[model samples]
Each structure stands twice: as C-alpha cells, then as structure tokens.
Target: MPRIHFIAIGGNVMHQLAITLARKGYQITGSDDEIFEPALSNLQSAGLLPKELGWYPLKITSNLDAVVVGMHAREDNPELVQAKTLNIPIYSFPEFIFNESRNKLRVVIGGSHGKTTTTAMVMHVLQQQSFQFDYLVGAQLNGFEHSVQLTDVPVIVCEGDEYPASALDKRPKFHFLFPNIAVITGIAWDHINVFPTFEIYKAQFEIFISKIEPKGTLIYNAADDVLKALVKKQPRNDIQYIPYALPQHDVKEGITFITIERITVPLKIFGNHNLYNLHAAYWVCKTLGIDARSFLTNIQSFTGASKRLEVLLQTNDVTVFRDFAHAPSKVKATIEAVKQQYPLRHLTAVFELHTYSSLSTTFFKEYKGVFNMADSCAVFYAEHALAIKKMPPINEVLLKQCIAQPGLSVFHTKADLQNWILQQPKEYTNILLMSSGNFDGLDINELKNNFIHL
Candidate 1:
C-alpha cells in the first residue's frame, strides 16, 4: 500500500477521497488548518483524523510515496513545500485520479451546473446494469458508498469541475482527467472570483473539449445555445459530437414521466434541467454499451443527488425542499421545477446568498428575476459569511431592486429569516430553501418539523 499525505484534507472531496483510499488499505494521512463537520466526524471515525489542525512540514517526508494536494492548499503550503524539497512526487487530487485510471476508460461530466446529478445518473445506471466501474461524484448519492473510487475497474465516471485545481496547478480539475468521453451539461457564468468575465468562464469549456482523447466522444446539451455554439466552433475531426436535448416528457398529477422510445417511465426526479442531465447520462451509458431499456429502468429509481431538489418535509398542506442552488441559473431552474411540479400550490422561494460569487455585488445582478416564479421570495445573507469571504457588505435595498421580484424580502439574520419562513401561509404551499450554505447553521430539520403539524 503506497502511503499518501493530503494537504488541506478538510475539503469535502479531499476527506472523502482519503477515507476511500484508507478503506482500500492504503496508508492515508492528512492535515488542514480548519475542519468542519461531516469531514471531521468522518475522519475521526476512520482513525485518520489529524492529531493537530494546521499545516506541519514534518508530515511530508522523503520516505512518503506521494503527496496529494487539495484545492485550498496554496503553492507555499508548508507540507507542499516540504514535499517539493524532499523530491517527493506530488499530484492534485484530480491529477492523482487520472494517474490511477490511466489504463482504464474515463468519462468526465463537466458543466457550470448539474455536474453532480449528471455524474450520479451515469454511475447509478451503470451500477444497476451490474457493470464494473469506478467513479468520482461531487455529491452523495443514495447507493454510492463514497465520492471517489480507485481500483482496477475498467471504467470510471468523474464529475469534471471547472474550478481551478490548486494554487500551483491553476488548470481546471477536469483538465487533469483527460477524459476518453466527456459531457458538458451547459454553460452559465460562475465563480466570479476566478474567471471574472463570462467569456473567460466560457473559455474553460472550450479548453475542456480540446482535452478529449482522440476519437473519443463529446456529449453536450444541444439545447444550450452558448454551449452548442462553442462546441460547434471547435472543429475536432477525430471526436464524435453527440448532442442531447430534454427527452419528451409529461408531468401529470405532479409526477414526471419520461418518454424513452416507445416506453414512458416515471422519474423520481423532476425539472427540465434534471431531464437534460438524464439525457446526457443516457448518451454516456449508451456509449458504454447499455441499452436504452435498461438505462431507463434503472434511472426511474434515482431519487436524485443530495440537496438537488431534495425534499425536507412533505404534508398534504405543505411541501418543503432544500436545494443547493446558489447560482443564478440553478436558482431559476430549481424554482421552475418546484412551481411546475406544484403549480396550484403557493410557492415561497427562500434563497441564501452564501457563495462569494453570490454575495459579491460584482455578480449580484445575475440573480435578477430568478425568483419570479415564486409567489413570495425571501433572500438571506449571514454577516459572517460575508466576513469570511472578505467581501463588502451588500445593500439589501440594492439587492431587492436588482432581483426586481415583486414583494421580495431580504433577511440578514437567521432569526428574522426563520420568523419570515414560519409566518408564511401554511396551507397549499411549497417552500424552497435554496442555498449552497446551511443558512449559517440554521436548523433545517427543526424548521421542516414546525410546518409538518401546523
């Protein structure tokens, strides 16, 4: 078993990867300055928890087989510096993943949104078909035991993130994977902190297409004009370009039924965006040799990736959903899904401006009209979140004006937000709590329970 040390292992994917490698009997050691739950509890349980928080150069030694780097680790991170000085091989998590799967077939799912859902869909259908494969998905899925798997499996499915890989390796994570087959769900400008302009952001996807292995396939969303235009502009003679659209579907009695060939199968998941993701997954599975019938049969049982249109509570009177829809496109798509699913119900869309991109006034205007579908819109921002990101304070009046939604409410305090939510009309309503953050430690379960018996 090769010994690996992780720098900044407190990251969501990093800790999960460490735990996964440990389970496979590899010697895993990791360190981070600050660790948060789920990662903390998970590392503790695995007996790989750092004895002390923060970087220690001593952890990286000449004897170590390799040092795996996480996104948050800076170029000058002491452990990283130590590893370099000791002549130890260093790999970013994605780079390491590519190294492990070099001999295997790799499928990379890349896009501004729905990376997790699309990747999870591919994994779910492939597993149900009893095909041997490995995977790296962004979110927790119902059946998947871990976010990453590294083995001798002949195939691997990866969520190709556009975020910069690490401080030293500034390329997008997906660039390292060098996929044999790739999926680009769509393009929506995001991560304003990194790629400041939309064109700059779109350029990343262009580069991703260029990275596909020769004669490999590129499955993309033909419905996305920007993505389609970009994909079409890139003239790759060796690559097979397959475009997918939302498969014909019907929503009856609040249930979405997808039409596959002559068969119409009911789906646990909803939304046009989700349908788009499923279509991409379908093409991937088809490329891997799974028939349409088997793919549709397995996809019917996919509840969805965690926090994407996830239901917190459901009563005849009220339905509460918590989603990780912090971006403008995602927020709009999620709201559309809920309102369309429960058109008759009064929809209250509650959003938390949690990410640096969302909180920064630089891109705040992008969220305008995203909440238009909701009957009532509520926006929350925690002061601490702003402080942590070191962004200037956002003016609530300006935010409201920017969103331009009728009767939209903005709350800075969790208490005020909770009160606003609880005071909402309970009967025949759908409340969607959308954010990338957990409302700054807001008790979601308790909030959901409050509405259950009301």
Candidate 2:
C-alpha cells in the first residue's frame, strides 16, 4: 500500500480526497494547523485524521511514498518543509489527480461559473446509466456522499478549476490535468488575487485548451463570446471542437421546459446559465457515446449542485436561496437567473463581500452594475476580512455607488444585517443570499427556521 501524507487535509476538497484514497486501501495520514467540523468528523470516520491537531515536522518520514499539498497550506508550512528536506515527492492536489488517472479517459470541465453544475450533470447521467466512472467535483451531489471518487473505472470526470494549484505550484490547477476530453463552459474574470487582470485570467483558459491531448475533443459553450474567441484561436488541428448553446426552453408556471429535438422534458432546475450548463453536459455525454435522448432523460431529475442557488426555505409567500456566487459575472448571472425564473416576485438580493477579490478595493469596481436587476440589494462586509486580506477598509459608500441601485444598503455588522432581514415583509419576497464564505459564520439555517416560521 502506498503511504501518503496530506498537508492541510482539513480543507473541504483535501479531506474528501484523503478519505477517497483511504477507502482505496492506501494508508493515508494527514495534518493541519486547525481542523474544522464535517471535514474533521469525516476524516476521523475514515481513520485518516492525524492523532493531534497541529502539524509536526517529525511526522514526515523518508519512508513515506508521497505527499499531497493542498491550497490551504502556505509556502513555509513546517510539514511541507520537512517533506522537502527528506526529498519526498510533493504533488499538488491536481497534479496527484492527474498521476492517479493517467491510464483512464479524462474529462475535464473548466469554467468560472458553471463547472460544478456541468460536472454534476455528466456524473449524474453516467450514474443513472449504470456506467462506472471516477470523478472529482466541487459540490456534493444528492446521490453522492463524497465529492472525490477514484476507482478502477475507465473514465474520470473532473471539475477543472482555474485557480493556482498550490503555493509552490504557479500553474493553474486545470493545467496539470492534460485532459483527453475537455469542456470550457465560459470564461469570466475571477480569483483576482491570483490572476490580477482580466487578460491574465482569460489566458489560463487558453493555456488549458492548449494542454488537451492530441486527437482529443474540446467541448465549448458557443454563447460566451470569450469562449468563442478562445476556441477560434486554438492552433491544434487534431482537437475536435464541439460548441453548445442554450437549448430551446420555455418557462411556464415557474418551471422550465427543455425541448430536446422531439422530446420535451420539464426540469426542476431553471435559468439561462443552467440551460447553458445542460447543453455543455449534453455535448460531453454525446462525445462519450451516450445517446442524447438518454442524457436528457437523466438530466431532468438533477436539482442542482449544493449551494448553486440552493433553496434553503420556501413558504407560501416567501422563498430564500443561498448561492456560492462571489464573482461579478456570477453575481450578475445568478440575480438575473432568479429574476427571470420568477418574474412576478420581488427580489431582495443579499451579497457578502467575502472573497479576496471582492474585499480588495482595487477590484471592487468590477462589481459595478451587477445588482441592478434586483428590486432591493444589500452588501455586507466583515471587518475582519479586511484584516485577513491585509487590505484597506472597503468604502461602503463607494460600494453602494458602484452597485448603483437606488435602495442599495451596506452593512458592516452581521447583527444589523440579520435584524434587517428579519424586519423585511415576509410576503412575495425572494431572498437570494450570495457569497463564497459563510457570512462570517452566520447561522443561515437558524435564520431560515426562525424567520420563516414567524
């Protein structure tokens, strides 16, 4: 059995990867500076958790087979330094995934917004068809308990993130995968802390496209102008390019109907972005030799990936949804999708400024005009976020001005924001809470249980 040590194994993806590897009969041992619940509990259940909480250099032995580094670990991590001193091979999470699945047919889904949904769709279809495959998705699906699964299966579906692989690896995570079947949903500027500029952010996708295996296929979203441009610029003649767009769909009584050639299927998930995601998944399934009809049949039941506009509470008069939308394009797309799905309802969109980019004063202007679709908007920023990012205090006045909505409100305190939410009229109002963080550990479930009941 290969002995693997995971640095910062307490992270969401890292824990899942460690658990998956452990289940495969690999001897997994891991350490983190601090381990949080769910991850800690999950790792403990798998018998892979470190005996203690803190990292120790003595834990790294020369006999260890390999070390997997997570993004949560810093450059100067003690365990990481010790592993380097012992000349142990260190692999970024993505790099290790590539190494593990090199013999399998790799399907990498890359994009800023819809990669999770697209990956989930492909996995759901394959699962429904009883086709065995390994996968690494960002969000937990309804049927799947874990996000990362590695098996002796012939195919592996991976959600390709454009973020840096690790502190030591400057390459984007997707760059290491070298996919056999690649899909780019769309290109949108994100992770400003790493990419810094839109041009630099878009170039990552270009690089990802270039890394496709010879004679492999490139499935792309034709509706996105950026993706279209990138696809056009591809110099590889051996790569097969398949472009997708939104399928013909109509909204009736707050539900979306997707028409696939002769078959019209009513879907539980609605929105243009989701429709685009479905199309991207359809092309990938087709390339995998799955019939379009069978793929569509399976997709009708996919509610969505967790936290991608997940409905937290719904009553006769009000509905509340929580979404992992932090980027400007994602913020705009999510709000528009919600409004378009329920045209008659009033939207009270609450957004948390949590990401390093969103908190940075330099990148704040990119969010301008994103919240104009909402009937009312609230922007919340935690003071500690500024301190953590080492950024100057975000000017709430400037944020409000940038959002440009007449009734825009900004809050620096969670108490004030919670009280404001509680005070709002509970009828015909759809609350969309958007963030990548937990709003500084706000109890959203408690809010839903208490306020919705009242």
Question: Residues 337-411, candidate 1, lDDT per residue (tens digit)?
Answer: 888888999999999999878998868799988988999989999998888888888898888878888899899
Candidate 1 local Cα displacement, residue 79, angstroms: 1.8
Per-residue lDDT for 73-106 in model 2, tens only? 8889999999999999999999999999999999
Q: What TM-score goes with each of the models? A: 0.97, 0.96
Poorly placed runs, candidate 1 (over 4 Å): none
The number of residue pairs in model 1 that clash at the backbone is 0
As for model 1, its CA RMSD to the true structure in angstroms is 1.5
Q: Candidate 2, which segments miss by more than 4 Å at Cα?
A: 449-454
